[model samples]
Target: MTTEKLFKVNGVELWAETFGDAADPAVLLIHGASASMLWWETAFCAKLAARGRYVIRYDQRDTGRSTTYPVGEPPYAMSDLAADAIGLLDALGVERAHVVAQSMSGGTGLHLGVDHASRVASLTFVSTTTGDDELPPPSDDFPRFSTPDFGDSAAVEEYVVRAIEAESAGVFDEAAARVLVRSDIARATNFEASLTNHYAMKFDGPQGGGFGELTMPVLVVHGSRDPVFPLAHGQALRDAVPGGKLVVIEGAGHGIPEPLWEPFLAALVEQTDAR
Candidate 1:
């Protein structure tokens, strides 16, 4: 069974859901830019839980059911998002956990490993960048997608489906995509806050030498065809963290598709169990 609740951290209420036994080892999953915990997918969480892990997924401050500051730019820095992750762990009474972070949230994971190393058992960065100066930017061949009209539910759903299909072209599931989009629309209280979160990542400058401080095991997963961050991003992340392992999925893209779930779960389980 899964338990869903709101956790207050640093005066912000973050919406979270957990699966499996509380006594089991914990795995905290952090979603990407402008995404909520819904992005983690129910099946994936259940599978991870089945591996005897206490899986936890949560919405960031400006997204989903979490508290939002919609009137202006988010009042917190990227470090604050890192603190929120630790705060959630504290609230759940989990002294340490393996972190599975996606896209921009990888920044948060890096921060956790640096600023709060004692709380993280391991780090898994998925389709994300290290914000290092030496890495190449996104591919020029990558298409620029227009923003969707959030006020129109159909438009939002269609937009989400298109985006997911584009990112996970080989493994897109229409039914699952619809469900995730619907859930996000139903619970989104502040659209502007979500945009602000995107801006925070957009302007956040280079992060130098932080990854070198992580003493725990690190796993970097990226798709071979990912146009956003590209494979080089993952390679740079692995290079930055000492003894980090990289798992590149052939013919895959930015999103974790259905086809890669088994391999991804296996990698995650391995990292979590290693501790």
Candidate 2:
């Protein structure tokens, strides 16, 4: 069963959903840029929950039902975003959790492992980079698509489909993508603010310095065909983090398509079980 609720952390209201028994080991899923907890998908969450793990997925501040900032660069730093995750754990009385973070939010997971090590049982990074400037840049073919105006529903739908297709290498369900995009449009209060704030992590510089010090078990999963971050980023992350394991999904792109779900969940469960 899944339960949705709001958590007040650092004076901000974060919307989150919980799955499985509270007594089980916890796993916190952090979505990437311009996405909500919805990005984790119901089937994926349910699968993890069925594995006897407590699953928690939430919208970061300024997205979904969480607190929204005004349109502009956000005032908070990357560390503040990391603190929000810890704050959520505190609210739920969870001392430690296996952290599963995707794309840009992967930085947040690294921060937690470094700054608040005791709160994290393990770490899983997907389709993410170390934020180091020295790493190879994204593929030349990466889509630099622009976000359409929020009021234009048709344009937004097309944009969402294109974005997903670009990330998943045209391996996504069109109907599900449309439903998610429409729901996101309706739920978002300030789409621009959320997007801007989410991407602001780029300005914070590379967060790879402390990876070698994280003692927790770590898993790095990447798509062989990811145009956004690419496979090199995953390789670098696995190399940097001590005892980190890397899994490459052949023919997959940046987005976690249906084919990768089972393997990914097995890896997650294995890592969490190690804790």
Candidate 3:
């Protein structure tokens, strides 16, 4: 079964959707910056849920149908986002959950594994870095598209499609991406706000608290060809945490492409199951 609801978390309403049985082990899916729960496509969540896991995906403060902040002004900090995660879990009566975080949310997951270790069963960080200053910068070849006019829906959709194309390795599906882009724009209270506010969001302190602070199982999934954070970042993360594992998606880029779902899902399942 599937369910959707609005949760009052951290004094803000966050929109959440869940798939599979409530009785099953819960796996929380946190998308990257400026993205909504739609990024974790319904089909992907369903497939993960089919593996005897309850999957939960939600929109952060300034994304999707959830609460949005004024353009270029987000009041919350990175730590506040972590608190929001805990509040969401409390509201759901979930004592513990396996967290699958992508890109920006990876730092959030790391914080949870450190400050709120009791609440996180396991952590899976995808396409993210360890925040180690020594790491290499993003790939020079990785393309970036310019933002489109917010008032023009077609322009916005085209921008999203082009961005995804540049981010994917070689298996990008323009049709599927367009569908998601349309939904994202249509449901957002202010799509432009997310784009602007995320950059403005504050950080309570340095992200990725001491690696020694983490005691739970940790998994780092990165594409071999990751444009941002590069494969070295993933390797460093796995090496930092005790018993942390790494899974490299061959020929993949910044995000999880459709073709690499099998290995990605398997690695995720293995990490959670190990716990």
**Best of the candidates, TM-score:** 3
Tens-place lDDT digits, model 1, residues 62-124: 898898875456778777888889999999999999998899888888888877888889999
Prediction 2 TM-score vs. true: 0.94
Tens digit of per-residue lDDT, candidate 3, span 35-97: 999999898899999998989999988999989989988988888888888898888889999
Could you arrange the candidates by lDDT from highest to lowest? 3, 2, 1
Give the poorly placed runs of model 3, Cα more than 4 Å off.
206-208
Each candidate structure's TM-score, on Cα atoms with residue i matched to residue i, is: 0.92, 0.94, 0.96
Model 1's TM-score against the true structure: 0.92
In the range 92-118, model 2's lDDT, one tens digit per residue, is 999999999899888788888888889
Better model by TM-score, 1 or 2?
A: 2
Q: What is the lDDT of candidate 1?
A: 0.84
Kindly report which residue pairs in candidate 1 clash with one another. Answer: none
Clash count list over all predictions: 0, 0, 0
Which of 1 and 2 is ahead in lDDT? 2
lDDT of each: 0.84, 0.85, 0.87
lDDT of 3: 0.87
